[model samples]
Structures are given as structure tokens and as C-alpha cells.
Target chain A: MAQKQINGTTIDVNDEGYMTNHSQWNKVIAATIAEEEGITLTPAHWRVLDFIDHDFQEKGVVPGMRRMNKVGGIPTKDLYELFPNGPIKKAAKISGYPKPASCV
Target chain B: MTGSQPISKVSIVVSRGSLEGIYPGLIMANGARMEGIEANLFFTFFGLYGVLKNYNDKIRVATVGNPAMRVPSAKGLPMPTLLGAIPGMSAIATWMMNKEMEKIDIPPIPEFLEMIHDAGAGIYACKATVDMFHLTKDDFIPQMDKVLTVGEFYEQSAGGQIIFT
Candidate 1:
């Protein structure tokens, strides 16, 4: 086994080069998450984050699909263009969806 | 609306007295969509006129009450209804708005409206006011969800904070 250094964290990599620690999944990496989803973090994305923060402040929970759909101000095509995979699913995941299973 | 959801949800109520007021709602709603936030706009009273296909063309913002407006020809001039009839008032207003928005890097109104619609923000007109004003579905913009009563608006606004600007 060869040890590799990533962000000051050492990980054992086998011939396959996969990190040895499954616990890494439990960590929150906002930048990595954004990169993984291909989000460029424009003021446009900040607008979404701000709205989500405001919604959470007033409502005490993240909105549901119905509300999300109603708030659907962003074009789905644009969203797909922005996120590629899916803005909603990726956003929900990054925001820590109320229930992960239902989120995806 | 999601309880504990981030205040990131953007809802705007259009109830301004001037053409200027109407544009903010339109711009913000459209901006919200572009940024990936959910946007909802409620057009009430005179604001409904902006969304009316026929009246939309006829709508004008009253400069009389706007402190920001300067009447070069005369001070304290009430926006003569006739001024609204000037052939280019709408175009002028659109131009001014587009210019100001460009200063802040915002897109133009038509593109903004399209983005807002494509993003999924539900646009609604006030049912009671629409009826009171003697307007019908035929008078409204093509994509309006429906004419909603205050009660209906409240139902929609239940989880989200309501903004009346």
C-alpha cells in the first residue's frame, strides 16, 4: 500500500488509487461538492443560496417539491445547462436535504 | 415553502404606483430565476394592468409621486395622463430600465421575463381586483397561472414570507 497526501490528510491508496477511508464520505466539502456538480458560483447561484437561507429563516425548513416548483424561477433548461446533472437534486444534496432518501 | 429552508426563496409582490415599480418585480423575479432560486410574483391592483396583454401596452408609471423623478419642464408637475400618451413613453421607460439594469449587469426585461417563466416561478394576478376591474383571462399575459384571491395568495404564501413591494 502506498500512502498519498491530499489536503494534508494522508490516505492509503491501493493499485486502484481509491482512498482507503470510507469515513471521508461523512465529511462536508462545499467546494468539492460545487465542483462535482459543475457549479461556477456566480451571483446567480448566490441568489439561490440567499433565497434558500431566507426561506429557511421564515419557514423553519427547506421547501418541498411543490414550493420548489412554484418558486421555479430558474429555467429548467438553464438549470440543466448550469448543473448538467440536475440543479435541484445537487442543490438539495449540498443544502443537506431534509431527508436524503426523498431528496434524490 | 420549506420550513427551515434558507430564506433563499424570492417572492415579490408588485404594487407600485409608477412604471418603475412594476419593473423591479419583473426584474427581481427574473433575476431570481437566473440565479437558480425559486421566484414568485403577485400582481395586484394597478400592477395587474402590467400583466394584461392589452393594458400592458397601455401601462405607464406615474412620475408624479416619485421623488426620484425630475420634471425638467417644470417642478411639481403632476404626471399629466396625456404625457403617458406620448408615442415613446413606453419605449423610453423600457430604455431607461434597461440602461439602469445594465449598469448593474442585469439582463433586459423580455429576456428576464422569459427566464423567470422558464425557471418555474408561478405568476398570478389578483382575482378580485381583476374581476373588479372588469378584466378577464383574455386580457392577461399568456402564461399567468390564474387569478388568485387574497386567500389563495395566502395559501401560497403560507410557508414563504410575503413581500409587498
Candidate 2:
């Protein structure tokens, strides 16, 4: 467990930088985290984040990449372009969710 | 490639062509990509079926002698080896496997490979196998990166974990 200071507020994050407490997430924190990852928040990025947040709320589990592409309406190519390091895992971390259990 | 350097890559060798054998490599390679680790899948021997443009779509589970094969609905009962030897049993087993995978949103072979490729995983075919089977470059899926010798694969996999499936 580690703590990260986002937008002047201290929050707990897992080793991979995913926010441990969903309640602690806010737009400002999202933006800050994105900046740390060398990305500037865009409407497209927000679309993914919003979808992740909504899906997690409804399903109580992080959606798989296939679901993200088929259901979230984001294609795999765009997902890679948006989050270059690791699309699904990075998106989950950026969206303040736990690392997907199915991901290696 | 210092020993102290953190492991950032993996090379998965897929040697079996059966649906059951191939999926493990695909799943593991996909999982590695999702973890932000560089993944390379080397399809050799029968495993080359997974990357072949034509055969990938038609691969079947080898039910005979597969002790792990279980009836999908019968949780405690194992599929009898003799039953597996009967005609059409392979098809039935394959259909059941597909149905099970579908329930969990696992894509079919072609689609799964495409997804992994799109996710930045490298897909390769073994040169020796390709030559022995009379397969040309065009015989592979468009995502196939290259056909390499085992030595070449080892060179590329230097300092990374090697997973055999």
C-alpha cells in the first residue's frame, strides 16, 4: 500500500497506482493522475473513464478488454493509442478501480 | 540484458495445435500485454495452426486421451476416454468449449489473436515448421510478425521469461 497526494488531498493507492478508495476519486484527481502518466485528459479519455466508472458501479467488476471494445464502443486500436503502456490495465488504474483480476 | 534488470518481456511458445493447448498461450500472452509487459508468441509445430490464416478458424479440441475433458453440465463426472474416441465426440467437446468460453466473453481463436496483436503483442511462426509444412508468408494471419528459427526466437527472448504451452 502506498499513498499519493492528488490535488492537495492524500489518498491510498495500490502498488500500481490504482486508487484503493473509489470515494476518493474526483475529476481533479483523474486529471492529475493522467498528467503523471504523461497524458493530457481529452474527451476521448473521459469517455473511457466514464464508461469504466459506470460499468464498475453496475457490475462490481472491471470489464474485460473485449467488453470495453464491444460494449464501451472503443476499438482496440484506439484503446492502445489512448493508453499506450497497457490499455485495459492503465484505464482501470486511471479510472480509480482495482487492477482487473483477469489481467496478468 | 543484465540479470538485475527487471523482467519486462515474455516469450510464449505454443507447440500444441488443439484448441485446449492453444488457448493457454493466447490467454497468457494477452494477460502479459495487459500487464504492460512486452509479449511475444512463437507458434511452432502443431501450434502453427493457431497462426495459419486458414486453419486458425477450424482448429478442434483433441478429445481422445484428454483426461481433463469434462462434460460441461456434469460437474463431478469426467468424460470417459472411450467416449472421446467415438466419432463426433471431438466436435461435441469443441462445441462445449466454445459455449463455455462464450459465456465468459472469450473470443474465438482468430478474434483472440487479432485482439492480442492489437494490444501490442508480437505473433510469430516457427521457420522450421513453416518450411516443413510448405507454408509461405501469405499463409499466416496478417498479424503474423515473422517466421523465425528457434535460435532467432531465443535471441529475441534474451533476458525474458520463456513460457511453454
Best by lDDT: 2
For model 1, the stretches where C-alpha displacement exceeds 4 angstroms are A1-35, A38-76, A80-104, B1-5, B57-59, B71-95, B102-110
Question: DockQ, per-model, please?
Answer: 0.08, 0.63
Off by over 4 Å in 2: A1-4, A10-16, B1-6, B72-74
Worst 10 residues of 2 chain A by lDDT: A95-104
On residues A1-104, what C-alpha lDDT tens digit does candidate 2 reach at each position?
A: 89988767998998878899989988888888888887788999999999999999999988888888888998787888898777877788888899888642
Please give the distance, in angstroms, between residue B157's alpha carbon in candidate 2 and its true position after superposition: 1.8
The TM-score between candidate 1 and the true structure equals: 0.54
Error of 1 at B126 (Å): 0.4
| C-alpha TM-scores of all predictions | 0.54, 0.90
Give me the displacement of residue B6 in model 1, in angstroms: 2.7
Q: Can you write out model 2's per-residue Cα lDDT over B7-57, one digit (the tens) per residue?
A: 589999999999988999999998887767899999999999999998899
lDDT (tens digit, per residue) of candidate 1 on B65-136: 344443333344555545655777656655565565555444434344444566677899988788788988
Highest TM-score among the candidates is held by which one? Answer: 2
